[model samples]
Target: MKFKTSLIALSIAAAITPSLVTAEESDIEVITVTSSRMDKPVSAIPNTVTIIDREQLEQQFRTTKDLSTIIGNLAPSFSPSRQKMSNTGETLRGRPPLIMIDGVPQSNPLRSGGRSGQTIDPAMIERIEIIHGANAMHGLGAQGGIINYITKKATGDNEHQVSFDVTMPNNLESDGISFGTSYSFSGESDQLDMIGSVSYRNNGVYYDANDQMIGVDTTQGESMDSQSADFFIKLGHNFDESRLELMVNHYNMENNGDYMAVTGDKENDIPTGAIKQEQPWEAANNQVTTTSLTYTHEDIAGQQLHLQFFNQNFEAVYGGGCWSDFYDPSMEGNDQVTVCGTGDNGESLYYEQSRNKSVKWGMKASMIANNIAESGINLAYGIDMFRDTTEQDMVVSGASWVPESTYENIAPFAQLDYDLIENLTLSGGVRYEYAKLKVNDYKTMYGYGDKEIQGGSPDFNETLFNIGASYQINPSIRLYTSFNQGFGMPDIGRVLRDGDSFPDENPSIDDSLALTPIVTDNIEFGADYQGEYFTAKIAFYRSSTDYGSRMVEKEDGSGSFVVKREKSVIDGLESNITAYIGDYDDVGVNIAIQNGEYDSNDDQSVDTDLDGANISPNRINLFWTHNFDNDISTRVQANFFMDKNFKDASDEVYSSFDGYTTVDASVAIPVYSGTLSVGIQNLLNEDYYTYYSQTVGKDTRYFKGMGRTATIGFTMPF
Candidate 1:
């Protein structure tokens, strides 16, 4: 591990040193980020943020459709990619970040089923904005900040335009051939503009470097042997001083693999594989539909006003039942009986499928005023309200895993931007939130003896604040600092499902089962240097919480888990440097280092450092790109992960992950009013294991990463 770390460090050092020449004038376009209520230039913002434009996305993320993998590569603070459909252990700075599409939240905060990261297809995204560290602007679920995906918009004066794109694997293997196609039409008139697109993709089976079938994890919604479709439409009309816009997006994805997992021998370095099997009762499915309406008034009594209303419907289903234990009344003393597929009558029963459904609606209204009272102050205030109902159940048995529950939240926030001096600016915000949850009485499932559980109504209220300042010392140098607060509620469903005694049997339900919210305080300091040929950024941040939420595995082998709260602290450093050598070539390097600790014994003392489950290992990314004169471009990239020991070494259930590096390359060429691209993923064919597969103790989850695969794609416009 130590030798591998040193090798990676040397490689990164060699790649950056040669291009660290003197700065010169360059023609870099300015990027605007919408992290705040208003769109501000990235150079002027005090927070650490990264913006990936359409060009970058098309060039860098053409080979893979995983959003987590794409974002993790570009952002330093973000954890390494899971390379799967589910983002179970992916975190930003040791905590989960809020995901949004067009300013509408997509994360299921109530249950957090680990499917939020895959809510939308990469083909539908126009740009992605990521804000690092804790923030209060977005209210709940922003404990580690926000990642907002902006959809495409109509452009140009053309009355009508069409575009088509197709991509497929170049490998000859029939089972490894994946294909996707998309068609889009956009038009703009004097007063109206509209854009719409429909896309469908069919994925083939996945194999490792050894040409062995990858293991199927029904619980994680594996993408292999799956099909997905996306539909999107947006329309906007302009008035003299007001504008109205509407958007609708639908996405459906499901896994229909014909194979089941076969556990491996981890001690012997053997990976889990798949074998042919009969189809289960239900395959893993993820579907979502969203609709939104937005209205904006440019000049309303010298204040700009914006109003938006949105609704979303979502459902996700997992694989069939594995194994569980239940109390059997047929026994003399009601002894617990373990069952895999047989019922009380010793007859075979269909495997039970677990699923969750959610319906959410929300509204937001905000107004911005400039030069308030001639005090050189810009003020922005907003009100947000949302209602969400979610439920979890077993389809085959009609049993409840999580009872139907409704969550209502209302928040009011205000932000101030003050021009402190000629080159310095000060910004601050405050927000107050009120939330309520209501649940009805329900009976536990077979696993819990089918006991009736009492329901309750709970309310939570909190106030959060943030402040920051940025100073432009020179034309090419800027310094910034910020202190922000963010909060998150516990997964109530997890708490309720672990109920051991009913309210009647344990009268102190409120005190014994009620979970508390977690509040985080983050402090960050950073500096940026932008020049014609060289650009660099460095940031350091620390976040602490009196109570933090985490998932703990169950000892009963049911593959179920519960959420718990404890004291936690996390701190990290991020740095990135990019140098452009002339007009055709560029080199870049990014590094991230993080550490986390928690009070495991609840003695007010931090007793253990966090493992891969909570914190990501140190990582470094390096890349170089060159553009030829004939409209051809090529890029080579590498990512390195450093070795680390798991925090819970005393627990035999934990495993330590070994460090490894991977390489990738791609080429793009322009042809006949279109672009043709060829890419090789896992160019080195490292034959390594994923972070989750390496660190997980169980054999069922042990699997190797994807092998080297070639892809070819083309896009044309008419």
Candidate 2:
């Protein structure tokens, strides 16, 4: 499937690239990036990286109102959006990337609750940096790559801004309407600069392609029916040859949907629907607060030194008892227990709720030394130390689902960039990581037989390395090759909950029952070409692992599963091209072709292919934008997905996702004091199920993409 899609996409690129003529040569703005710990020009970085500036973010948000979807459309290797709050299967380079907010980790590595993608509000973001592929610069959870959301910074002398926006469905439907407002203030003096902003948003119910109420996903949370708010502030003071900065941010969101899901008929391609229900509890809730302090000294003893300390607190509450089914054995003889208490007789009953809470604190220190031994070599060395504590429990029953676990990690790394020759550079890095985990003994939930699970402490120490080289063929082109190692641990909570224990049994933790970490070796080769009016890049990479963790279905077909470690291999090619046509029109195309396989039988042959749930299918995205002289711009975008069969076909009634295409359009114009934006998502209104919905057999999981919904909003600034 990927081969066929690649051919077609390449053909389209060949046809479009030559038609757009180049404009006069002009100096393109150079973007500075901090993904590698050392600041460098994006063009000089020997990896696939993308930067989404504030302007682009605002424009994209007008169309999708989702951060993950915007990134998926702009980045070639990223999977298509799931159209939901949880980004469970949205992998990059066939693996999940570590998400960060202002260099502070947001991902829950120990449990992977899948809510990290939306930890921060897009309204408060200044820009986003995406580093693709594996590297050792950031220790742990970089198997695929990293995405950092850079918060807004103070600009200009003294600025104060206020904005408000409101949007509703084009058809005048009462559902799916939204309203938002924000206020920002910034000031700069000779020594100090500061920026602060606050925002609030309220979202209404969602409707699908058929203009019908969409089903509620109590487990993962739905963005369409939520209320969110955010507050951010940053202060920076510049001293002679040194700088000090402090930042604080708080975000909160909660689902307010008053409906519940009703199963649909999958054989006929019918999606689940929602029905009014007597409220039991809020669907989902999330809150996050972060604080950080950073100090940098330039030319300290002929070297640059930087230090950062950060802390974060997070809590998430999920709706109902979605995790498992519960019944009172003592009440089995009474019909009232089955009918009245369980809501089987049409009477509403309060639903059980679950919550996850975590706290994380970390510090990092690094130094950059130049001209080592007068050999035209630059070196960056850093040490990172962090600790995280996480726990999950039932809100009503006070039963522990996952016991409080504490993880501490300390890593030190060094990287060198050598100017081996004029126009040629070599880079290498190595890191030593020491991680320790501690968990106390606890009793399992009543639904899990109330077993006493003994906890254990584990420690790991490993050394990882990376090497790369880049050759500047000319001012317009460059070639590069790299090899890197990445490491990550399995979801420990998943492993512990799958133990073979009952109410009458107690098991002790041992090495045999402990989860092991996974290590991946990645290799890539790529080329970049930049012209006065056009830019293009192509990269081919291969990643292999001896023992990688994956969730697989159990043989009993009870909707329960366990995590297994197996040999796996993933290889892919990604390409992107953008052309500026006469400065008024811009066209771009992105293609991603990838495949993954694992050794399911343990024969080490890697015979079983991975599914869309694990690996993204071949995808192509194209966009064209036109700008008018009157401060107006319009953009049209299209996305296509290729059909691919699943590796595990037994559980799926429909084993493959039928390919589909979608198009969206948006226009922006300067209004009163700010901007007015109008967009029509799914312009064609093609009623199609998402890849995930098509493959999953469960009726309640089937969801169709949104319809041709028109949105118009104006932001007024004062």
RMSD of each: 4.7, 4.4
TM-score versus the correct structure, for each prediction: 0.92, 0.92
| Candidate 2 per-residue C-alpha lDDT over 1-718 given as tens digits, one digit per residue, 9 for 90 to 100 | 0123553455344211111113333333256777779876665667777788887787787776678788877875777777777777778888878888888888887777777876777878898888787665666687888888999988856887876666665455776787778888999988789999998988876676678777777767777778899999999999989999999999998888677777877888778777877446657888999888999999888999989999989898877643233333333454332232443443333346678888999998999998888998999998999898988876755556778888899999998999899989899999898998888887665455556777778788889988889898998778988898887877776666554422224575445333677788889887766777666777788888888888766776456556778888998887777777776997878888888888878888687777666788788889998999998999898988778876642434236778888888999999867888888888887778877777653687787777777777667545
Candidate 1, residue 197: the lDDT equals 87
Instruction: Count clashing residue pairs per candidate.
Output: 1, 0
Lowest-scoring 10 consecutive residues by lDDT in candidate 1? Answer: 13-22
Off by over 4 Å in 2: 1-29, 322-350, 501-506, 512-514, 555-558, 648-654, 716-718
Give all candidates' CA lDDT scores.
0.76, 0.76
**What is the overall TM-score of model 2 with all chains considered together?**
0.92
Model 2 has a clash total of 0
